[model samples]
Target: MTDIPRNPLIDQDVWTGRLFGGAEGSWYTAGETRDVTEPATGERLTNIGLARAADVARAAKAAAAAQPAWAALPPRDRAAIMRRAAAALERNLEHTAHYVARETGGIPAKAQLEVAEAATQLHIAAGLPLQPQGLVLPSTVGRTSYARRVPHGVVGVISPFNFPLILSMRSVAPALALGNAVVLKPDPQTPVSGGFLIARAFEEAGLPPGVLQVVPGDADAGAAVVEAPEVRMIAFTGSTAAGRKVGELAGRLLKKVSLELGGKNTLIVLDDADLDLAASNAAFGAFFHQGQICMATGRIVAHRKIAAELTRRLVEKATTLPIGDPASGTVAIGPLINARQLQNVDSIVRASVQAGAVLEAGGTYERLFYKPTVLSNVRPGMRAFDEEIFGPVAVVTPFDSDDEAVELANRTEYGLSCAVIGTSLNRATAIGDRLKCGLLHINGQTVADECVNPFGGRGDSGNGGSMGGPADAEEYTQWQWVTVKGAAERTPF
Candidate 1:
């Protein structure tokens, strides 16, 4: 296995390989590279190759050319390759965590978790090739008929910087496993963990040439992926605004598109609930990974009877949590991904406070480490309530009844996930039924994902493109109906 070089010497060719068959992206030959800076310290981690629109088109064409042979391989052979790829990916997890921590400003634990989850996704993808691809159907003419799922030829993937590894792997692994070629365009902010590493793993596991093309790039490469005729489908994970643009372009080209967009999720607290447990769950949901997750609880709608107490608890927890360079020690929260992100988060906090929300705990920062924050009296029009903060800020509001709670939870234009806290499962389930998000957690936090459960959003959050077993089957393949018989069939004409 080609170990991801750990020397930190920033060798351009070593980190960003220029080979076409998954070892390197096509853009490196042009000698135009982008600086990947560490968010925590503003240190230049490495200079990664940048992909152009032409490079994306080239990669897509290569991936399309390689699909037939890859699909022709036996399913068992494909599955074995997938398993080996999973193993190869596992070998790099430990060192990869350090890189992720530095590049993305995530704590060691968060980085480790991302690596572990990425490996798990690969393991799940290993079985995708072996799963039954078709269903037997009865024919009107008494002929043996069936419907089979076939690969989409080439899939173009555009991933984000936050949770880079798992987000990119979930789509790449399944598409590759189901016999589809892929041209991956990871966010330029996270080329290493999101693009090159996964491609290298597959290549090391004996994947044939041209099956996977890694393109680490910015908007030009992303636009090229959607516009390239060879890419039959698009799997994009990013902000809602960007996702809408992707969907628009893919739609114009008549391409199959799966969009995993942003979220302004919520967690509802009941009057009869345990405030301590609810507060704990809310804190983790709102501040975990510094609330950069799509499923992070953006708003906490508590019962008016207990809103004050919950707000106090949240404030206490937020004020005490450690904020520093996560690579230096065990900090509860790390820096924002970059100065841009830090400014955006700060703006939201400042705007909300100006718009009448009370900042109970924090609303300041030193460098990129924005303190975990708590805000009370937040209303729908405030930036903290309406916008996706994508930071370590929890906005608490009060709802008088279950109906009001449901109304508050469902008010956001984005509907990705929601959580309900109540004394009994039946009570929570009753409240959960009214919330109109794609994923729900009764008496739990909103941040969760597994191989079995479908992951996606609703409304502005996404366009019904989810990731899971059933979703993988549908997203990675197209349907075809076939009929066979001993005798010649009659022609309708």
Candidate 2:
């Protein structure tokens, strides 16, 4: 193993196998540790402590204990703290971006984007508490009735390694704003930058102790967080398979769970669409961050009339994207998270080619750096078209008509997001309205997400619950109806 150089951006002492928890700002060391490696160079960045099941329980208890005081504070007060946290995040943006780039194998530009998105999410969540909650109901002559939103006490957040900061904050910020305490477990692969930095931001922002806990660990720790009795709700973002397991466990415990899972997102281009714009956006949506996004465009449905031109343009664009070390600043695409992911992507490409899909641009790799790949002639039966290929590979299939386009788009079990590109906005809107996905983009890519939008999916992509804007506050809370009766004029016989 290469000797990892010290990163000026991170506190070496704090990052070496320490978990953050409690209001006293204490750090605890676990019995076992795991080495975190940089995928760009296969160098061990640092050893992270793995939290055990007991640790999860302890953190949950602490969050539960701290929730009441946090809930007791006025919404504006909570909002103030959240805003301060956002400011702290902005102040540390440079360091955080560097850490994210190195740890997650994302290019500096994408890492910076992630940090910016996280800060924006925090700022948006700050305003959630100020939004109107519940409603007054018309009642009988002498009675009044109303419903109010209330916190769910302790919320467990399980975030994936890819886009860890944004995904975690999707739940943590909203949960905090709604007066619920949070116990966060970031993916073990990206504990320091993805998990620890957010904890530090909150601590520096003067959040009360114990209200927020950051525990970094493997699957055991994740299961513990789900099984903990004190965790009233769980907000999870990961693979569809893992999400099912979380849902099953949380269901057994009768805990409310919100899941954001995998997607085989589709991007459709009509015959009248500008081929250049469609190809460029498709390349961006498919290859951005090595295509490690849930909303990445995995499948492209194009009108048969323009399919050849669109495929040619996409292939031309894919070959020019820089793929190298993330820290170099000039690279566009970086390494996959690990060898397993690299193998998974390569195998999928190889299998699709063997199954009769034509590889138009890229189908090669050295170590973890995969070339941006575009596969044409992809049919319905090919795995590349049917499954979620979480890599920089775009599979294109031709559709004869608008009805055929909608049919092909909705054929997949996953309905997370879809994009429609066409010359006419009215035509695009007409097609988008017919799509079954949770999110739709007209004349754009499928990966765009706004800070104020309720972000999530439908069908296997997620539950009906969303993760941003005012809807998030509702997701993290419960409703309680309060009724008052005037003095009775007569007694019952």
Candidate 3:
């Protein structure tokens, strides 16, 4: 294994303290500290400060105190600050990417892409205030009415480890742009890249103190933020099980919440599709980021006429991809986030193969690294076909017709993402429409995401809320109706 180059620009300070309102330098010493390890090598990276309930309370109070003034600021002025933050992120992109690679086991190239995506999201969010606002309604005689959008007081943002930078900013950027204060809780696994890097960006950008707070900890810190009465809303991105718990707790408290949960996404290839294109898309979608993405291509449904050819091409593509240490800078597949993830993926692959699914390509693991794997003859009852195997694994199932393909794709409880590849655009579009999912692609894989698009899912995936574009402002803010009496003279009681 080649030694990973550590960017000297990043130091221990980047992993040290939790941010409080206006006090960017304040370090929280009241909680227990935990060691963060590199998933690629199991080496101790750094010890991170964990925020407990008391720390959550302090951050919430500070956020609540600062929200009103931030909301009162003119929209353009607030946008200017966000733009400055975007610049700061760009300036520190290399350091942030290094942290992402070191902590999450992402290859340096992909890590850089994540950081660039975050910067783009910040820039996109900076324009939120300039977009159209609430509507003016027709009122009854002698009265005029209009509705105005306003921010939630304080929003709690809980993000997962995979794609930490992009996921965290998906909520944080919109909340801040909509004039809401944020109490962000990043996953313990990637605290420095997910939380601290974000805090430093805003701090350098000169955002007003107390508008943003980052608390890095485990479930205790996450629960603290959710239980904080001062937090009016919660925007969360993680596993469906965790999201359900968050939704249940927030629902009981009557606090607004948006959850971007899991997915057992599918990719369909029709009889008339280009086999090579389909194979390429499937390989990239299933293996990129080691298949840690929520929208990774978990299932592939191919028409019987082309199923065999597609499987052959997929195997050829999957086996050729380089796999090794992420720090090597030459490998395509990196390590899983931890040993548990590695074990879980291995178990599923073994069980699926034992249950009649044929292992076509790579299915072996060396410590945290799992090779890109492909399974064929996968049936509905097989675990690989039904479950979300969040690893570099792709399962292929044969379908007789388009109707059967749609049925197979929609059979899962998760309706997060899907893709249809066919020679005829109209047929592909029709097939895509029938797949019950939030995000769909006509000729590509289920992996593309844009800051300007509504990024979320349906069914067990989420609760009918989105996390990007102008719609996000609506999710993080509320509406108020105002009326003015045109000809009021006197009141009679």
Scored by lDDT, the top model is 2
Residue 363 CA error for candidate 1 (Å)?
Answer: 0.6
Model 2 poorest ten-residue lDDT run: 1-10
| TM-score of each model, paired residue for residue | 0.95, 0.95, 0.95
366-468 per-residue lDDT for model 1 (tens digits): 9988899999999999999999999999999999978888888888889899999889789889989998899999888999997667888889999987887
lDDT of 3 by residue, 170-244 (tens): 889889988999999999899877887777778777778888988887788888899999999999999999999
Stretches > 4 Å off in candidate 2: 1-9, 485-493
How well does candidate 3 match the true structure in TM-score terms? 0.95
Off by over 4 Å in 1: 1-13, 17-28, 140-142, 487-493
Q: Score candidate 2 by lDDT.
A: 0.88
Ranking by TM-score: 2, 3, 1
RMSD of 1: 2.8
In model 1, the Cα lDDT at residue 247 comes to 97
For each candidate in turn, give its C-alpha RMSD to the true structure in angstroms.
2.8, 2.1, 2.3
Clash list (residue pairs), candidate 2: 23-209, 23-210
- Report the candidate with higher TM-score, 1 versus 2: 2
